[model samples]
Target: MKRAYGLGTRSVAVLLLSVSLAGCGLPRSGPSKSEILAGSVEKLGTTYIVPVDARVARAASKSPELGFSADFVTADVVGSDVIHPGDTLSLVIWENVDDGLLASKGVNATELQELQVDDAGFIFVPYAGRIRASGNTPETLRQAITDKLKEQTPDPQVLVSRAAGDGATVSVLGNTGAQGVFPIERPTRTLSSMLARAGGIAVDPETAQITVTRRGRTGSVWLKDLYRNPRMDIALRGGDVILVEKDTRTFTALGATGGQTRVDFDSPNMTAIEAIAKVGGLNTNLADPKGVFIMRDETPEIASAVLGQAGLRETQRVAYVLDLTQPDGIFNARDFIIRDGDTIYVTEAPYVQWQKTLSVLTGTASSANAITNAAGG
Candidate 1:
């Protein structure tokens, strides 16, 4: 019966090993590469898996981002002497006679400093009836004042200049070297000049966004684009609000990468290779070089172009595959762009699971050996 007893003991040991492995649960970060492929079958899962190539990279790189529209880019440049209500004006008046009605006492020229424009756009000048100043340039206002005063004094000379006032100023705020209300002066009439006058953007130029809000409409563009594309520097108007802020675009890293977290875009036009490096590369011990995937929700047009198909009616779920083991894999990844809201996942190597299985088997065998030794003793 010794032979029968030995077989029974071996059967028990095998049963225990099976139970132990089942209890361990495999301990995985995410689904394996095989599982991902199997899950993508028709009617089984929703993710459309597409391998990354030069063509796909080109198609996916055209992502929509924040930028100014034609309305903002085509707006005319503001003139320094443009008048507005609440604006301050300085005026000088002269007459053929030594002392005129608007002239200073004992002075041939009358100096009117800090003349405020009323809400109705009118400014009252001594001996010159109230005149509309808003919607007119300093020269135009000068002519109006001259015509009005000429009836009272012959050969009247009038000069009008805009002074620093609550009107015709831009509120510069957020991530700027200096944040406050900046006047729209001669050098600070356009967007670029106004930003410079506010001490420029305090954030990185690559991630900085310059936003302008005018009459309830808003437009934004990268700070670098402002300098590169001159058309983006539109004129600033009175009561216009300007904001400089860091980019809020981000992508998530999951699975076997260095850190499973959301990472912000630190540069413009981020690529898959740059994203990998930003997340601390990959976990060398667990990462599968051939299973790097970037998942994104692409529009129907872009999806059709990437898949070489047409008539995609809705937003398509796309998983872009990358195999770093191939000769051109690194190059392919370098060219593949990573957009905001994408998820990067690197599967664990297959052998890593096998290693765990072997460890479990060896540990069980060692436990059996110890039991046998104890029984013999």
Candidate 2:
């Protein structure tokens, strides 16, 4: 009976050990708060593995297409200050020899005529009749009038100048110090120049995003990029709407790292290394070196390029892994771009799970030993 009891006690200890090991293998009682906040989209269905090289290529390919056409930019630079319909012009007609209409006016062979271009794009000049002036530059209109007056007078000189008009204006809206319709005063008015005229960006320029909407299509560029790259400050069109807004691009940091929160991009070109640094890096004790992941929602084009298929919503959530254990992984992290709305997760190490199981087993063994000691006493 004593031997039987000894076998039962041994069996109980083994059973307890097995139970603790089983608990370790099973998933933890629900995901941690961090996990829920940055839950892996992989659970949704299909998750593609994006390599660092592939991610870099994808990021490089995401340059915003020009919203306005080349013709639009050229027009802004060339004809921005040109008089259009609804513009009033001060016209002075002078003749070297007093003759024709100015001579009849009896004013030293010169006449000052204030004329406004009609909606039909014509300005009525006495004796010169109706002249199309809407699309013509002031110098071009002056030449046109001179050519017409040559039929009646000798060497008639004409000066056409803009008196008043709804000058070339762009709507400057959103997070700007002053929001209103800012006139494009100069023919060479560029995006940066316009922003300056509108009191510059109200928010931090590093954290500001600029979007230009022309006609109906929209394109965006980082305000920081515009500051760094002068070429990106394209000329602003007359009707273009320039929106200077706070950067809404954010990524969630989760798992064995700093606190989980949606971290905003300080700049548009944020890499995985930068993102990790933003979140205080990984938890040294619990983080899995091989489990650094950046989860992103892929566009259909990206999904097709990476996963070989599209249409499946599940396939759109891609997980890009960067294993710090590999020698090249750190280098890859520097190149792997972290896109807007990505989730950065550093999973717990497998050894950490084993350690938890060991703790449970140690506690169970201590309890069993105490029971045995009490029974013996």
Give the top-scoring candidate (TM-score). 1
Instruction: After superposing candidate 1 on the true structure, give the runs of residues whose Cα lies further than 4 Å from its correct spot.
Output: 1-16, 19-24, 41-43, 94-99, 103-109, 154-157, 164-167
lDDT by residue for model 1 (181-227), tens: 98899999899888889898899888998889988999998888888
State, as a TM-score between 0 and 1, how close model 1 is to the true structure. 0.90
lDDT of 2 at 362: 70
lDDT of each: 0.86, 0.72
Angstrom error of the Cα, residue 184, model 2: value is: 2.4
**True-structure Cα RMSD, model 1:** 2.8
Off by over 4 Å in 2: 1-18, 21-45, 50-76, 88-118, 122-133, 136-167, 227-231, 299-316, 368-377
Q: Candidate 2 clashing pairs?
A: none
Best by lDDT: 1
